[model samples]
Target chain A: MNNIEIKDLSKKYAGFLLDKISFNVPSGAIVGLIGENGAGKTTTIKSILNIINSEGTVKILGKDSKAHEKEIKKDLGVVLDDSFLSAYLTPKHINSVMKDFYQTWDENKYNDLLKQFGLPTDKLVKDFSSGMKMKLKIATAISHNPKILILDEPTSGLDPVVRSEILDIFRKYIEEDETRSILLSTHITTDLEHISDYIVFIDKGKIVLNVPTLELLEEYGVAKCTKEEFSKINEKDYVSYKKGKYQYEVLINDKNSFKKKYGITSIDKPSIDDIMLFYIKGER
Target chain B: MIKGLLKKDLYNLASYKTSLIIIVIFCGMAIIGTDAIYWGSVVIGIIVGMISLSTFSYDEMAKSNRYILTLPVTRKEIVLEKYILAIGATILGSLLGFVLTLLIGNIMNYVRPDNVIDINIDTLLATTIGGLFGVSLIQAIQIPSIFKWGAEKGRIQMFIVLFVLALIGSGVGFLIKESGLSVDIAKLESVLKNFGLFLLILLSFIIYFISYKISYKIYKNKEE
Candidate 1:
């Protein structure tokens, strides 16, 4: 079964609206939720968790999020961008509190995670730096041995070394349980680019694209050519294109086909960042 | 889940150094200050009520509710937990107030013997229950308001509710005066005094239940 499934989910506000967006994370893989600021990544995640009101349904482990939210949440671990408990609380206090919140609460795992993350057990959360706070949140999310881990910007302020370490932890977590799945949302595309098995791109509250990361890395490429060469290429061959100072960097869906048809040697594999930039900022 | 939520709130309240300081000062005043000694349990009740409200403010400051709702707890459970925390704090505060009343009353009577501020057990019981009842009523509306609109916006709602209440009070007074009804203050006081304690307790629970229902609805409908 798909571990996490969001189907036709939509949320509306005065000025913003998350259109009917759908995606799925099959068991045993990490799916990167990529989007720009205000692109409804948080909104979509909130909707799926029933944190906000929405029209469509989100199913986790084949149960509706709203109907069986409490039950569904038992197997779900969440790490939000903002810290969850009072800033006056320490990790020690949280351990005591979470001892009751989760039936799967593991004191040893929690303490070990705290030690691993280098988080001070005595200091108040308010006193911790942003990176430390994020790490603390990640530590809490994983200590419960959840079947699904949903993180919203889990590594925003984290330094590169710490970010990679956290990613490795995620890798190890999934390796530990093949049925475990991860839906991590972040703007730091490089972090996900290395580990994400599938990438879902969201723009203006809509799912612009959803494809396997392998396909994105292997099949997608940028075709850089002169204005004369750009005019010769068929409009249907490229998804979007950016007009550079001298050359036109066109984003194509089938790099192999474009290479075979046009014999373009300038084609290079596109990063998630490049795809996001081309999709959001480049013209069709 | 509710237990977990309350535990977290208790930790938050305990960590608030200023709240701890305020509690100490209030209890200290209850010991030494003559007027404070008379108020006894009421002083401690007010302090506890203020400290309990601080938990809500802390939740907002840290945006903890978003994280909390994602846990295996429902929004109704969250509202219920806040109510329980408020009641728990009130009970703790009442105990402190009651003990302080007895201790200070004895000390003052011992030190002065004559012209002393004496608080009897009956007065302490009456005032402590009365003060807690009022505090609970305010929290009934206040907690729900804070849940619906955040701590800051909820304060404005409280002001509006108070303003509406004042308007109704003035209208009632004006109508009475215009109707040539004689204002019998002592008779009215005697009527209220004669009111059954059981009835008052019943009303308090009813009000609290209604408030819980409202808070549950508001919190349940609230967006993360």
Candidate 2:
């Protein structure tokens, strides 16, 4: 079962538009929304949360998002990169306040997370380091034992140690409950490679690719060939190509099929970042 | 859900506890020995009532409105919580002011027997209710403006609104004077003396209700 089903969700701003976008976060899977800055990742997340008024439909846990927003939200845990309850509140204050919002709020779990994260209960959130603040946010989000987690750039601006620690927390969160799901958006593709089961790539307000992470990493490849050899390859077989001084780097969906068809075998495994770069900057 | 929102705001405002206590004490001390001791309640009431609206600034500072929408609370509940906080603060502030004025006035009377200031219960009650009404009017105008704009921009817009309201009031008064309106000072004073406190409290509630409706309308479809 899909935890979130967003269909043709669109939002229009003064100079930008989130074109018709559709994706799903299946139960027990991590769906990472990967895109560059201003590429509609945050807008898509906002649309799912109903924080913005957008066109099209969003279904969360089988209920219409708009119709059952409050009900759906009870089971949703959200963390935004730049937004939280308040910067002035301490961890203790947050625990006190959150208990009133969720009947399922586990103060012991929250306090345990805070202790594990080394976050001071009395210190104001504004005074904490970015890493500490993010840990606090994640701790707050998961303390209620929410069914789904929606995080926007949760790992952005954090150092590798903190980022990996956070990723481990997410991993443990899912491992604890097989029914739980996570949909996180990040430009840091490497983090998604480690945790995300599926990748939904968006570029310039449109979804360019959405596929399983293993398929993207294991099936997709970059073929470097001479200019003359590149001319021999059919455009239909490759997704996109980047031209270089020495050769042409073509992105293909299937390396094995391309090798069989073209009899060329210099295909390199493409990273999520490489695939993203090729799609955004490469020629059609 | 509103309880959670209120607690969040109350915690945010708790940082002002020391400042608020200092200000209240200062106001009480400054007015305790004076004949115009009644102004203490008005001053304290206005200060406390106005400070409650700073919760909007706190929300804006954190950009928590968007985060709040993700909670299991409707836009109506979010808007209603603000009104509850604002109205609760206004009433609490007025009550504090009334009690402090009475307490300080009696203390001063005991301290300076020769210069006893008459702390009239009715007058203090009227001033407290009148102070509440005045603050409610400002809050009524300010809250909707804040919802339409933002905390920072809304404050500026509210001042402009207040300016226009002031100008309108002056214009109406000038027109009345120029039209040679017959004065019924004694009758008007009698009516005010009888029902002024009740009218002020009733008007405060009515204005707050209208302000809440306007705020809800602005916030219902607002994007973050």
Candidate 3:
């Protein structure tokens, strides 16, 4: 079952356009939406939540985002980077307030997360560090046992140890329910390297690639060779190429087949970051 | 959903700790100022209006307003909560005014009988009702503009609203002087009696409801 299905998602700003984007996060899959800043990642997430007036149909848990928006959202947890808690509210105040928002608010889980995150129940959120605030937001998101989680740069500004812990929490969150899914958007491709089952590369509002992470790892490779050697390889075989002062690195969709045909030996598996850089900035 | 939104706003409002100071200021003014008993409801009304509008500033203070939309509530519910908060603030303000008037009047009676001011219950009722009407009128104009432009931008609109209302008032006063039956307290009371207090309450609510509808419409289409 698909937990989220966004079809023909389009939003226009004064100078930028989020062209018709279509993708889905199947049940139990982590789909990472990777795009540079101003690449419409936030806009796409906002459109999915109906937070912005966008032209598209977003289906969450098989329900329309607009007509069934309320019901659909009851089970959807969303966290945004800038939308941290108010400075005056303590964790205790947040608990009471969230109790009103969710019918199945789990007090025990919230307290446990607060304890684990090293957050004081009585202290104001404003007094917490940026990393602490991020943890608090994630804690709130998971406390309700959401069926779907949509996070925009949820791990930004956190230390490596904390980011890893948050990722572990996400892993446990998904493990709790097989049908639960997550759509996480971030430029930190390393975070998605291990967790994301699918990678959707978006650049300039258009989806450049939507493939399983395993498929991306298995099918894509970067061939580092001399400029003369790179020139010999068919332009049709490589998706993109980057020219350094010393060497040329060409990216190919199918390394195994290209190797057999071109006899090029220096082929390494392309990381999600490499693929993103090549797609967004590499030469034709 | 409206309850949840209101709970969040109410919590935020209380945490601000500014409401207490505003109330204290109102009390201070009431105790020392002349005709303070009569102006209690008006002061309270303004306090409520300011607090209710302050919620928007808080919501916009951070991108928390955007965060809130990700919750299960509709944009309509969020807007509805603001109206509810406004109503709550109005009641709180008006009651504070009324209670202080009585307490201050009674205190003056005991401490200095020579300085005691007798505040009529009928006048109090009329002012409370009038205060609610005045606040309702201000909100009806202010809320829609706030929804269209945020709190910062709406500040300019707020001044413009006050200016327009003043202009309208002076224009009406000129019209009355030009072709008038004698306008006095007796005439006003007679007109009020004929128009009916219940009718005024109903009219004010009707205008408030329209304002809420307009605010919701503006907020629904708004992009964060």
Candidate 4:
């Protein structure tokens, strides 16, 4: 069974729209939701969590998210961009508060995570730096040993060192097989590149690509050639193109066929950022 | 879970314990500032009223509802917890205010034999009834507004509520002076004594249940 299944989901805002989003994150798989700003990644996450009014079905662990929201949320952990912890509250207060709310809350796990993150139990959340606040959110998200972890821009606005530490924590969280899954949304594609097994690229509220990360990299290649040589290639073969004064870079959907048509020069791998930029700019 | 939520709110409030202590001390000063018994009672009532208003505002400013909703608890639990906290704070603050006022009244009585003042059961009952009514009004307006409109918008509604209450008070005063019912205080006291306990209990439950229902509906329909 899929860990999460979002079918025909759509939500409309005044200036933003999330249109007919459908995807599934199978148990134990890490799915990266790649999108540019205002591309509806956060809206999708909010809809899946039933945080906003939406028109469609969102199922987690084979249960309807809205009908069984409380039960579903009990085994799910969410880390939003903003810190929901009040400024006046300390980690010590959070521990006591969580103890009451979560039946599966482990005090030892919470304390260990806090110590590992170097968060002071006595310090108020208002005094925390942005990175520290992100760490705190991660600590709380993992402390319950949840079945699924949903993160929105968990690594944005953090130093490289802190970002790597958070990535490492995510790696550790998904070590268990078939029991843990993650749906991570980020504009920073580099962070998702290293850990994501699947990538779903969304542009302008519509999905452009949804496939295994390795397959995506294997099937598509960014080819660089002179403008004269670029004309020799079929326009239908490429998803997008970035032209320069002396050279033309084309994103080929079928890497193998393109290599066969022309002698393989140097086919560059497309990063998540490259895919997002090219797709949004209608370059490929 | 309710206990945890309640404790969290209390702890959050505790961070400003120093400020709260200062306010309590100010209440103590106001209780002792006036020489007349009626003036002292008015001061105590105003102080308690201010505390109730501040508590509601602080809870909204802190976004306590947003934080609580993220937990595994239900929206119903969140609404019930706020009601519990409001009522609990009112009781605790009223008791503290009563004790401080009684102490000041006794001290003044000792200093001047001719102006001796004593707090009887009637005084205590009146103070309790007035405090409960004030807290109920605050919660009735604050809970629904905050739950529906959020903290920023709710602040405006809070001011409107205060304004409406002031108008009502003045209107009642004008009616008393115009109709020559100034002597009705004795009759009012007699009626209060006869049905005061029952009325107070009924009003408290009615206010809490209504506030709870309104807040719950707002929360259920609220979109992040």
Candidate 5:
């Protein structure tokens, strides 16, 4: 079952518009939203949370996000990339304050997480390093035992070790409950490859690609060929291509089919970042 | 949920406890030998009452409003929490001011028996209430402006509005003086002395209510 179902979601700003974007986060799945900056990733998450007014519909846990915002929010744990509760509040103060907002707030769990993450309970959040602040935010968000965690760039500026530690936390969170889901938005596509069950790539306020992670990683490939060999390939077989000085690099969705059709067995496995670059910078 | 919001603001304000104590002590010492003692309570009342609105600055400092909207609280509750904090602070500040003024005056009088400053309970009450009315009016106008703009821009906007209001007040006073309006100074003083406190308290509540409504209207459709 889908924890969230967004249909034709649209928001318009002064010079930008989030076009009719649609996606879903299924139960027990991590749906990673990947995009460049100002590509509607944050806007889409904001719309789903009802923080911004937008056209179309977002149903969280089988209820309309706007029509039943307060009720739906009870089951949602959200982390904004640049926004949080006051920086003046320590983790202890946050615990006290958050308990009043969530009936199921787990103080012990929060404390344990703080200790686990080595975050000082008394030190002000403003004094924390970026990684420490992010850990605290994640801890607070999950302390309520929310069914769905919607996070925006939870590991944006962290080092590799901290990022891996955070990814482990997410992995363990999903392993802990089969009903819980996560809709994580990040430009760190490699992290998504490890944790996200599905990938939804957005570019310039529109969803460019949405598919299962396994399919995208396994089926998509980069075909490098000589300039003369590139001329014989059908454009329909490939998604996009980048012409190099002496050859052409094409992104093909069905690597096996392309191999059989063109007798070319030199298709290289493409990373999520590679695929993203092909879609964004490659010629159509 | 509002309790959560209040707790957050209160904790933010708690950071000002040291500054608040220092200011009060300094203000108290400054008024020790001065006959303009009534200004002590008024200044304290205004200071404390105005501090409550700084919660907006704290929220802006962390860009917490967007995160706040993600919680279970509704927009109406968010706006209501600010009014509750502002009004609550105003009332508390007024009482604190009144009690401190009396306490300080009596202590000073006991210390120097010859220069005994008369502490009139009635005048103290009037001054505190008048101070409250002034603060309520400023907050009433300021909160809506803050909601329309952000904390920084909203502050500048509020000052401009208050400046305009002061100009209008001066113009009305000028017109009354130039027109040589037949004024009964004694009767006017008598009316003000008798019912002015009641009128000021009533006006404070009325302005606060109107301000709350306008703030809600501005915040209802606001994006953040």
Candidate 6:
């Protein structure tokens, strides 16, 4: 059974829209949602959690998300891009508050995370730095022992050191079982590049690609060649191109065959960001 | 859930303890000056009612509703907890205010016999009932507004509610005085003796229950 499935999901805003986007994250897989600003990554996460109204069928753990929202949320963890802590509340206060709302909230796990993140339990959340606040949110989300973790841009605006620390936490979380899954939405494709089993690219309110990370990288190649030889290659086989004074960079499918046929000097592997940029620009 | 929510509210309000102390002192002064302890108690009760409304507004402004809803709790539980907390705060505040008023009254009586003021049980009961009635009505209207339109718009709705209540109170007072009926203190005492407790308690519970249902519907359909 799928861990999460979204079908024909659509939400329309005045300036931004999430078109009929659909995808599935099978049980035990880490899926990365990659897009630029205003690409509806957060919108999709909100719709799945039923935080926003949308027209679609969203199923989590084989149940409709809306009909079983409270029930489903019991086993699901969510961390939005921004902090939701009340200015006056401290980490200790939040723990007591969570005890009342969640039946499975683990106080030991929560306190352990606070120590791990170096967050002061007695200090008010408003005084915390942005990175600290994000750590607090992550602590809260994981304390309930959720089966699925849905994070939207959790690494945005944080320093490299903090981002790596958070990624380490994600890695630990997924090590529990192949049945546990994570749907992480972020602009920092490098973070996903190391850990993601599947990458889903969304742009202009629509999904461009949803495939295994390794297969996509194996099939697509970024080659550097002279302008004359670059033009000689078939345009249909290439996804995008960049020009230079002495050389040309082009993204083509079947890297091995293209390398042998054209005898290119270098065939570089495309980063997740590079793949997203080329697909978005070339599609338009 | 209700206990947790109440503790959170109380924790947040801990920093305002000095303000609460000042308000109690002011109420004591009002009672000593006016020599009408019951009316002074009524003033203190109204102040506490306003504090409850302000707390609800603060929660809205902080987007606490959205955060709480995302947790493993039902919207119905959230709405029910707010009603519980509103009533709990009102009761606790009114009890403290009453005790403070009595202490001040006794102190003044010992200092100056000529200005001594005595508060009867009936007076205390009347003030408590009136305070609860006002609190329940305020929450009944304010909760729905916050759920429907959010904090910024809810503040406007709060002012509108207060204005409407003021107008209704004035209109009722005018009719009572203009009717030329026997407006004796004995009749008022008899009315209180017969049904005031039942009426006040019933009104408070009914208003609270209705508000809970309305708030639940609004919250369930709310777009975060």
The alpha-carbon RMSD values of the candidates against the true structure, listed in the order shown, are: 2.2, 1.3, 2.3, 3.4, 1.5, 3.3
Interface RMSD of each: 0.9, 0.5, 1.4, 2.3, 0.6, 2.0
Give the CA lDDT, 0 to 100, for residue B63 in model 5: 92
DockQ score, prediction 1 = 0.84
lDDT of 2 by residue, A49-108 (tens): 989999999999999999988889999999998899999999999999999999999999
Q: How well is candidate 3 docked (DockQ)?
A: 0.68
Maximum-DockQ candidate: 2
Select the stronger candidate by TM-score from 1 and 6.
1
Which of candidates 3 and 5 reaches a greater DockQ?
Answer: 5
Off by over 4 Å in 5: B170-188
TM-score of each: 0.94, 0.98, 0.94, 0.90, 0.97, 0.90
Candidate 4 stretches with Cα past 4 Å from truth are: B36-67, B107-115, B161-190
Name the best candidate (by TM-score). 2
Alpha-carbon DockQ of candidate 5? 0.87
Q: Which ten residues in a row have the lowest lDDT in candidate 5 chain B?
A: B30-39
Q: Which ten residues in a row have the lowest lDDT in candidate 4 chain B?
A: B36-45
lDDT of 4 at A279: 75
Per-residue alpha-carbon lDDT of model 3 for B145-212, expressed as tens digits? Answer: 88898888988997898899899999998988898757688878888887756776787789889999
Predicted candidate 6 versus true structure: per-residue lDDT over B1-224, tens digit per residue: 66767767777777577897798787787788876677666677667755665556557546666666567667777777777767777777667667777778788889998866776867876786787687678878887887787766887987797899899999998998899766789988888789988888898889888988888999876777
Model 6: docking quality category: medium
Write model 1 residue lDDT over B1-224, tens digit each, in one string: 98899888888877666756776676766467665564767877777875788788888899899999889998888988888887778767777777878887787679877667756676677777787777777777778788888898998897787678789999999999999999898997786677634455566678778989998887777887
DockQ for candidate 2: 0.91
Candidate 1 chain A TM is 0.97
lDDT of each: 0.86, 0.94, 0.85, 0.78, 0.94, 0.82
Candidate 1 pairs with clashing backbones: none
